[model samples]
Target: MDREAKKEAFRKYLESSGVLDALTKVLVSLYEESDKPSAAVEFIKQKLGGPSLSEHEKLQAEKMDLQRKYDELLAAHRDACKELEELRNLKHEGDVKEMVDNNDAKEM
Candidate 1:
């Protein structure tokens, strides 16, 4: 494509994808800053790195918390199952012992 066509295409892409609006808002925020940053890059970074970054961090923390809870619950379930199996084994042994005792009593 030619230079004019490429420029038009880039502008259209920026406008259609909301990049233009985001840049405009960032620039406006930088202009309104009481304590202006020394560097333009820093100003842009500060304005652009707004709520989205914090929201992502908050979501990560919540995910970690949920994962920890899930792990604890899984461990507890496994422990309970192990205990149940032990109880079952003990009950089976007691039944066998009772049968043997009854047979000996009958013989006597």
Candidate 2:
């Protein structure tokens, strides 16, 4: 109901969910590192089993590549459908021409 009460409830939730313990362990590991990482936040995130910056970047690149490929494939599919429709129309026209020619020949 109050600000302090909300903070206490959230803190209890974190402790009960083991988030506080996990963070403590990760922090301890970072503190004990012989050579501290220049990117301390990234180091802590990685220690906490989150993706490091480079890995995140690599995944982003991969997703972009896949999206590009999907767009290309979609364009190709649309083109193929258009071509197929044109071919069907041509065949229909040819069939109609043949029928008309046959009727003219019968009249002659």
The reply for model 1, stretches above 4 Å from the true place, is 1-51
lDDT tens per residue, model 1, 1-108 = 999999999999999999999999999988898987778775686667654555768999999999999999999999999999999999999999999999999999
Question: What are the lDDT scores of the predictions, listed in order?
Answer: 0.89, 0.97
Clashing pairs in 1: none
lDDT of 2 by residue, 20-63 (tens): 99999999999999999999999998988899889999999999
Task: List pairs with backbone clashes in candidate 2.
Answer: none
In model 2, which regions exceed 4 Å deviation?
2-4
Supply candidate 2's per-residue lDDT for 21: 98
